[model samples]
Target: MKKNSESKAGTSRRDFIKAGTAAAAGFMVVPRHVLGGAGFVAPSDKLVIAGIGVGGKGESDLKSFHDSGKAEIAYLCDVDDRRAAGSVQRFPKAKYYKDFREMLDKEHKHIDAVSVSGPDHNHAIHALPAMQLGKHVYVQKPLTHDVYEARVLTEAAKKYKVVTQMGNQGASGDGVRIMREWFDAGLIGDVHTIYTWTDRPVWPQGIQWPAQKAEVPKELDWDLWLGTAPYKDYVDKLVPFNWRGWWDYGTGALGDMGCHIMEAPFSILGLQYVKDVQASVGTVYVDEFKRGYFPESCPPSSYAVLTFPKTDKTPGDVKIHWMDGGIQPERPEELGPNEVFGDGGNGILFVGTKGKMMAGCYAENPRLLPTSLTEQHKLPVKYERVPGGASGHYAQWVEACIAGHGKKEVSSPFSIAGPLTEALLMANLAIRGSDLRIDNRYPGRNLKLIWDNQNMKVVNFDEVNQFVKREYRQGWELPTV
Candidate 1:
């Protein structure tokens, strides 16, 4: 069976002709059985999927969908051939292309859905058209590069009536459900304050762009990779992963892991568009006398505070603190001196009127403070468990697509992922606002920028609104929903 599957994996769409010829030679295959009628596909029929950005995390995403056994990898697209090599080898029969536009243009008929696992900047660029063409989309986390794009995609999902899921797999994990149960049971009363921190940037940041430019790799399409970001001379090591630290291509640490770290609280608390946001970021010194301020690059470390209006789950407004670049909140008194705080490196903490709770990245390993409370408390399960938990996220989206739009429930559909993404980007506005300088003076400092979620703009800070919706490059435009 493994050999048979391998052989099938290597067959391209062009092989259909050969398959037809073979079938005509008295070797017809069994027809799929439909329970209701002949028009309906049998349970065995798989959804044909096209993967955009089939490298790194994208490569793993394609594998997960294929492994679901309910989806067939029909096409793979990527700008970097070297990065996409593994996926191309694994899905031998899948057609390959460098530009996602070309792939979607030619293979739209053959693709049932599109899985987008690209850099933060190009997610919306790749996803918008696919959705317009009525293809279901599963975009990797941070859904879009900016707040406006997130809102557009969210509305587009509903307008197109396509099954949509953001690649924040933790949204479907048991850890969040367990935490939800605890919160609903009033173990941790109304959550008034929340803190999520990460030791990210693990990449270069708080530095100037390299003065020297390097030759583009032979196998990589540098122009195509830039997609919606402004074009610049090729820099060393920016192709595969280092792009995360740059403002043009990435969303810094908060956007990198915010979805994973803050997902549980957003869901359990029913949080939405933030009411207001403010921030302060650490600075790097280029020399003994001069401080480094690279607007193109994210700051080395920063702290942001977002205020969310009250929801039924909370008594009043919720103040959420986000720290990155190795910053963390203070440890709770309930925890032992040596006890781990949110898995020791990155985690989320919730402080309520009654007690405190914390969880590591992806809301995993959730526990109430005092350690003993986790094991001692018993709460009735009120949420449905996602099949296969976090790992099930891919299969869930695949099945949802197979079931058609609105037919099945998806764990991190655009509706939910969009607001979460928008809120994060809103927090980012504060970070970027605080960084703005006017003749060596930071004017955006110490101001609580009011937000008009409906208009998607910062009422108090007009300059920061530029980051709300970035202008796309000449060739790419965010599709009008």
Candidate 2:
């Protein structure tokens, strides 16, 4: 097992100093204080931000950015006006709009940044335009509705020269950073397999089918809510919150939670691409009496296996297994007595050659193995603490905007997130049908899938690739990458 801070593992303080100096030389500007809050400005001096989706997560985003004091609310846009009422009330000074484009066109100069907290499909639509306008963007997790869109947004951010951050805020946390430090220190030797699962029973699992059409609420915009997605009659069950389980709107359990649980291993291990992936889905269960928007029936619970080849940077193979619908992997005995596994719906379990490590969703406080080793582990004596929690994520992005800082070399840029999203999105594809095999490595193989990041298509499977990128209804197309 590797040593923790208590044990003084790997690099010494002097070595870290040399490394830090080298890193500093690569970047032209240096802050007045290396570890102090000198480079950032007060929230009052921060830029003006608009919210594209001001319901659900969007509401939370408003509070986070507002609390940062680094941004002023300039606009609130949501298709469902009723859902946005609270936000509209909170920011009376900020204009409210049912459509985002109207707000963007009229208040273009007044907005300095945008928070995209819409459904997975709508994220790219709102974010791309904002970035194209040189507005900094803070988009929610899973980045895009489809794999191709993720790539487009990443490229656009590069061309526009804007500061960008995905909603997977856990990626910026101290716990996540500590996880990286431990891995680099070789605490877990040659990690080859990982298990991630979520017991998301709240929303029904699988795309069994849609329930019967019901009266659309008087206050909701049914047509607008269905933006970009296929035209479907309004159903009471599908609206408000349960849209995630449906194929047309949400990405089911994996897409919904993958970014959160998959982040630790992806960041700490530098997992770049998936070599192959296959999934076995449960039977589709249907509810005869369609209440709200969703049909009562749903697909059976699912289990998927993702195989990742060794990359140039990480030369060891890794396997990621996902479990959902009240299922979990067999706990390893090595965790020892008095060890409590995470009780939450999502958790990550890492098994290295020497020891094991596990962290909860959102990269909260993690627990390491060999309880006795805890005392022996010596972490890097010197470290920098970035802000934490949801508020901190927004704070960092706002700070970057004011400082004119761009993407970090090792950070989770849109380029990285795009592909990461693609891999996760494939799991959703596999669960949709059976006997589908994906070989992302090359096109020569018969099962080859070639991705045109710009067009968002798989050349061979035009029909299937069409699903990779979505089509926008009139007036809703996200800007081209």
Candidate 3:
């Protein structure tokens, strides 16, 4: 594990400095007095940011933060130079490094925050160390790879008192707020059932890992790319995006889209931690009568149901059904037979006693079913709309980080994002459990896995616990409190 002052297990910050690494390296820790008093804003202050996994979504995140003007891109890090090309070109002035640990170790004194947009497996590894350094962190969705990491990061955020944000931009969108207003106005009375669906895993899934090993590409550091995942030979097409299908690197379709599509309902209903979960997964048959078994990959498709006990905002237990891999719920009767059902490809539907309402990805274009009701009904807007809506998510985090912890409110801080992520990962536990085979029989099939949220485990099933907190590869371990 990387030693840091923030880690309870490592040498304290004061001790590390006194030991002479700071002196020998000439590392200068910025004094709090220079950053100003708590909650006191210096008009000239700008947050210095470091980007970990600077490619694709990571590239976009960096641009958005730079666009905010309140944040400066001081460093960029990624294992694959090919993926990092665009960002390196775009931010030529920012120092670049291939390993985040090296960058953080050498530049922690200079960075005020870190943006983690790496693959799902390494999110916690990158974000936790930064938080330990007292630097604010902006981690992308599916907050962590396992249930345990989500809980660890959540608790660490509070322990370190750092401003943290999850990159679920929809949390900053107006549609969720509008839906919240509608729900509060009783337009959709007591939503007991909700459905979120997506057409993802467009890449390969329900398939076997490539049997043929290929030479590692020159631009990519295959070992570093693997990060916390167990070592494996490099394979074609897995580097850029196909990693999403493998359980070793990604969280499948649900992890890819759940944070966005589920945010609105989660926010409007004040939902968190699940009580139990059950799932039915779609399988690919290799032959006329035999089903193909690819334990290493995410299934081609899956439909999971999660039960969340009543919260302050909910009238009773809420049942959330998640469908992915082009699987969607039945269209509401009020929707025109020819009319689109939630932007045609993906959507969220809420069934309440009074009516039904639905929205597309990111909770965009939310509408009360029967279309006419959306136009005719207007409720008082009780929630303050986010400035610039979804687009402002980056700027909001930048401003909040600059303002320091607790100085401003953020839409998807880890406190909320952690529970939301854990709930989704819990659903995955059921999906994975459904695939367990015992004596040619599906031992875990169709069973409701009771969950002990406080304990973070399946109360009735031990088989699914393997996924609750995955074991990191020999070299990488999640930090302890």
Relative to the true structure, candidate 3 reaches a TM of 0.93
Q: Model 3, stretches more than 4 Å misplaced?
A: 1-44
Tell me the tens digit of each residue's lDDT in model 3 across 315-369. Answer: 7999999999889898889999998898788999999999999999999999998
lDDT of all predictions, in order shown? 0.84, 0.67, 0.86
How do the residues 238-339 of candidate 2 rate in per-residue lDDT, one tens digit apiece? 767787776667777787788877887887777765655656655532356542222222334677777777755365788889887767888767666556
Clashing pairs in 3: none
Using Cα atoms with residue i matched to residue i, what is each candidate's TM-score against the true structure?
A: 0.91, 0.80, 0.93
TM-score of 2: 0.80
Model 1 pairs whose backbones collide = none
Against the hidden true structure, what lDDT does model 2 obtain?
Answer: 0.67
Model 2 residue 75 distance off true place after TM-score fit, in angstroms: 0.8
Q: Candidate 1: where are CA atoms >4 Å away?
A: 1-44
Q: Residue 112's C-alpha lDDT in candidate 2?
A: 70
- Candidate 2 residue-wise lDDT at 368: 70
Stretches off by above 4 angstroms in model 2 are: 1-44, 207-211, 285-300, 381-383, 405-412, 435-466, 471-475
